[model samples]
Target: MSAQSPIVDLPCALIGFNDLVALLHALFIKHGTSPEVAAILAHNCASAERDGAHSHGIFRIPGYLSTLASGWVNGHAVPRVTDVASGFLRVDACNGFAQPALEAARALLVDKARSAGIALLAIHNSHHFAALWPDVEPFAEEGLVALSVVNSMTCVVPHGADRPLFGTNPIAFAAPRADGPPIVFDLATSAIAHGDVQIAARNGERLPPGMGVDSLGQPTQDPRAVLEGGALLPFGGHKGSALSMMVELLAAALTGGNFSFEFNWADHPGARTPWTGQLLIVIDPSKTAGQSFAERSQELVRQMHAAGLRRLPGDRRHRTRAKSLEAGIEIDAKALQQLRELAGE
Candidate 1:
């Protein structure tokens, strides 16, 4: 990893979205990002947060910058698609980080779906993508239904066993809604996300019950133990495990990448390398509903909202984003300090 500069303590202040993006772009460039690619990455990171995906937001800068420094990912490589066909697309990331490839693929698929009414895209040779929701929500905003799956470095243990046999294997779905943000459902198939465990460990906090098992395959709340040798449990028990397997098969197997538990996990050379894969499906609702799709979706959303179901999946995120935009990025003081230090500021 490249050495970061020192940390600087600063208070949060109001900053325009574009200003924040410029700062990120400058930071990435200072860390060796090509000027053009840095802007794209900064845009993607900011867009993720705008859609309420904090986990994949600016916090990911360190990881991405480090990956670039280690030569594990190509910061300048442009992803290319192969086996392109109507309603189907396949992309090769060329050993680059997943975001740029995913963004390009998503745009291509959205256009393809608009023309063909539906499209499926598979991607391989990508690195760990921070959040799954950002990849699918755009389709929903465009009045299409979207589903996506991604396989990660193995951190999940199948039920009745231990030793980390599968990746968290996240899946996300989105559909247009009549009001507010699109209806989005994004979650790790594991009992909890890897980030959650990392966050817990950073804060020296214990995980809630049934989240993970220790190296000995015994359930434990100690986040550090879980991070060390333990594995995360599947959410919803067997059901979640089944979903994880399905995602691995669909995302990895179909894309001709390493399977779950078979992927490289090490960040350094000679260690297990990360070989992530993803699958995306987009459906144009108007094709099926004959142009009334949007109206019907709005009605359904109205009904759901009237039922007193507060806080739809992505609602809080949208709200938080609006607040953040109104009051700067609200970055953690410590995180900013660390970033500045990394940049040698």
Candidate 2:
């Protein structure tokens, strides 16, 4: 852990990537997840930790385990992929986690895009509990333009509305870069992600300005209020609200999955699968921009790097990943304790 970071009574543990994955695998297996599915989820968690996204890494294990324990997610799901139309493929997640389903379709989807210029993969009845960049970064690494979107359980209020109507719908985009790693970026339409608010609450931390509103529709920076009987605020006001709506249409409507509001919170308050869907598009820029695609991309990136005033997207993540892969992952003490209990260690 960095010395600059705040220290607590309990010191965090530095766990090797291999050990972390093994721990998650054991926990998932204990929760009745098949080895293959467990590995996929483990890999996703490890990747998130490697990239310094702790919110989606070990922080999410308990929630995933609870859902699996509830028998709401099919641990052995192998996700069926089928052809829909020209350059369009559909994947049925069988009420399973999203990673395995997307992984199963990667090779075929990439090949289709390479041959057809663009390919769309619509994932239905899946639960996306991880970061979106992990889904698209690999595609970008292969010199493809990747775009992914997913909607979750509703928590964000619509623009100019007091009640919650949308999820913290997330969108991720990536473009290949010859000079460096892919230009990967992912973000939720809400001013703050629901997971982030929960994380803050877990750590007993306050939230930043304009992140959410209290139960009475009043703006507040308290994470507790934002999570309990309150709603998150859409980022950029109307713009983020519109983009959140777009995600609902693209990921939910287009993919034939449940919308955020479709979740019946009153019926099942316990942990369960997100029952969400995702849309991913991969495009071979080579087909559209011809031979100059790489050169053009390099030129723009080179200019930006030369200026030194702005940092490229994904650069920080790449740096963090390198450090993590070399040293290890720094896990919070509480999260480590939970992992130990979950693994029955």
Candidate 3:
């Protein structure tokens, strides 16, 4: 999710990546997560902040804490992996966070991909509250092409529909290139992400037109209305809706997980994360590509630049990552203080 509230001129403080991770780890542990789970989640969240994805960064700490407190998600559940086939892997997250489950099965998944030329991992009974890019980018870093999708809670209205029936399902892809960082992109099928809506609400900002509708199915610009009893519109109408449906099929139905509408967290107060499923496909390009896969990818990028493309999908993030590495991640001072408080520092 992108940052909805601008903090560029806010009173800020710079913190090293490691320091931020330590703080987040302490905070998660304090909120009832096991040490191992805390470590994985901490690194994931901190990486978002480091890459300028503020909506899924420390901005999500409160939701994580509340969900933990409600006991809606297991803070210590271990994932059980099943090698369904030579190129297929399945994981039952035991009602835990999806990232940990992915971490648990990542090595086996990679091994299968290398050996079989392609591999698929289906993770179910899990909650995924953070950005999806982080889940697939590492595979690209390891020289594997990766694509992932996850369905969130039901908040988006399918095209030509009167009510919401689909989540802001996101698709993320990452591929290695010889000349630069991995080519990566993560995008919500909805006009906007649910997290961005929440951020807009909290920051007293109004959404742009066509983002969502109120309880009465009337167009609305107020973020609170959208969060309280409204529904988001799918991006590009039918095109995005079709992709969202595909995500539901891949991430939920195929994974033996709940569909967006099948999820009922009403009984679990403060449970904000969507307890759905995730699907990941990894490919060993070397197995099929006639030429060097990374070199081919770089060539494509060069052609795009030649065609006057100023920025690629992950340009801002890579630039931000480099800057953060050199100068530390600049965060709002108040937000940093809140993180410290959460960590009981």
Clashes of each: 7, 0, 0
The reply for model 2, stretches above 4 Å from the true place, is 1-9, 265-269
- Per residue, candidate 3 scores C-alpha lDDT tens digits across 1-345 of 113343444699999999999999999999999999999999999999999998899888888988998989999999999999999999999999999999999999999999999999999999999999999999999999999999988899999999999999999999999989999999999999998998888778999999999999999999989988899999998999999999999999999988988978789888888899999999999897488899999999999999999999999999999999999999989779878988999
lDDT-wise, the better of 1 and 2 is 2
TM-score of each: 0.89, 0.93, 0.96
How does candidate 2 fare on TM-score? Answer: 0.93
Candidate with the greatest TM-score versus the true structure: 3
> Over the stretch 247-271, how does candidate 2's per-residue lDDT look in tens digits?
9999999998899888553444445
**Candidate 2: how large is its RMSD?**
3.4
Model 1's number of clashes is 7
Query: What lDDT, from 0 to 1, does candidate 3 have?
Result: 0.93
Model 2 pairs whose backbones collide: none
